[model samples]
Target: MKEAILAAIKAYDTIILHRHVRPDPDAYGSQMGLATIIQASFPEKQVFSVGNDEASLRFLGKVDEIADELYQDALVIVCDTANTARISDRRYTAGKMLIKIDHHPNDEPYGDLVWVDTSASSCSEMIVSFYETFQEELTLHEEAARLLYAGIVGDTGRFMYPSTTSETFRLTAKLVHFPFDRPALYRHLYEQSLPMTRLAGYILEHFQMEEGGAATVFLPEELLTRFEVDPREASGLVNVIDSAVGLKAWIMFIQEGDVIRARLRSKGPVINELAKEYGGGGHPLASGATIHTLEEMAEMKRKLIAICLETV
Candidate 1:
């Protein structure tokens, strides 16, 4: 991974950084942080962060993107994306060299050198490893440090997620040395607006649980329109519902314009492989898919219920 990164840095005159679409904090953070580091270190080279916007991840930094014509001799660094389809831009393939850095359970290689470790809490953690390996030569500026720190905390649920480890903390401790207020970041992440709070309450009121303790919440198009929360804000609502009493697994059914988007989560042995069945995929513990209507979501819930019951 280090060699690939170093090679790409040295080989290409123009470096383009990209991440997943509808990006979570980690995805945007890693891209901004790594791009900042590269640009600061190698001022002679042209570095650009592409395919991200300021809407979803506005807290991190100014998101930058360049035109497709610029990818001719660019070395692309793809961060925090597991699958090719999830990559925000298809023009990444046009780069002179491709390097993928991710933390997902995939064996397939996406670029010249692929680093995929499911055990790492997030790609930002693995990027920290690279920073450490090149510590002698690299100095993480304040912007890079802040962005990386946000990625670490966001993806690890503030270090509460299971994937967090000694290495995660060690790297995080190193990152904190750079100046950024931790409290401010936390506030921006967890604090809720009035609309968001009301939306959460409404979703909570509609929660249901199966006989086997699998929780489910179905949000019809009307409710979503009434609340005005973007689909991004409603990203992992099922996981929130899973905190209900005796909950083992959970599902959130959201009605988009013409489709029902499903988010699934499992505690144990409750594999929601519905993502795989419906042309989407993620970890067994967390997955998602989109269906045509409420009836299709009900059918998927039935499948998930069967899986949860068998686990119990």
Candidate 2:
């Protein structure tokens, strides 16, 4: 990991950070945390975090936007994303060197130097651990600490996921020293608006569970418009199905125009390989795919159900 970081810093005077599109707290956290570290450590170098506009996560931090003219000889560091297709910006490849740091199970390497560990709970955890190894020479600022904390908390479901380990807690302990309000962060995360709460209730009540405890929910785009909630507000719905009792696997398909966006998750046994089959990628426990029509997504879900039945 140090080799990759050092090589990137030495190769380019400017560093641009990127993560997956449709920004989540974890993606935003890792992006902000690493950019903060590089900027604070090497004051002479210019580091930028570029991706989507992130209208929802604006409170976390603002992403830097540099013109395309600045792309020459720049180093692009992509964090937390498993596939190049999911990366927020394809323009990142214009950089002289690409560096990837991720904790997802897939080994679809997209960078000159790749550091991927499936055992880690989140990519932010991997970044923090690697930084700690160089703690003697590097520093951790409050901005970096808070952002890292947000990633750790978000990805691990506040340490509820099976991937959480002793190292995760150890790193959490270290990050708290920077002095951020824990309660406020938790509130911003767990607290939802009344409309969102109502939407969630509707989703849960309408959810259907097949044999072998595989649950599924299909949300039409019209429902989102009716509730005045954006796509980001629907992010937690798949996770909610994942926590349902006796659910071996779950899927959430949202209809938007001609496309049907699907989020797949499983607790055990069943391997829902829908992501790779349908032009997306992520971990075994969590994956996503978007298809041209609901019929296509339904066929994919049917395949997943067949796999789950065979496993059972």
lDDT of each: 0.80, 0.82
RMSD of 2: 1.9
Candidate 2 lands at a TM-score of: 0.93
lDDT of 1: 0.80
Indicate the worst ten consecutive residues by lDDT in candidate 2.
267-276
Give the TM-scores of the predictions, in the order they appear.
0.94, 0.93
- Model 1 segments more than 4 A misplaced: 270-272
Candidate 2 Cα errors over 4 Å, as ranges: none
Against the true structure, candidate 1 reaches a TM-score of 0.94
Tens-place lDDT digits, model 2, residues 1-312:
676586567567888999998878889989889888888888888889999877657768998878996778799899998878779977879988888888886658888888888898988898798779887756679889988999999999899878899999999889998778888888887777888888888888888888777677888888988987766568666776566777788788887677777888888744546677888667777778778886786787687777678766
lDDT of 1 at 246: 80
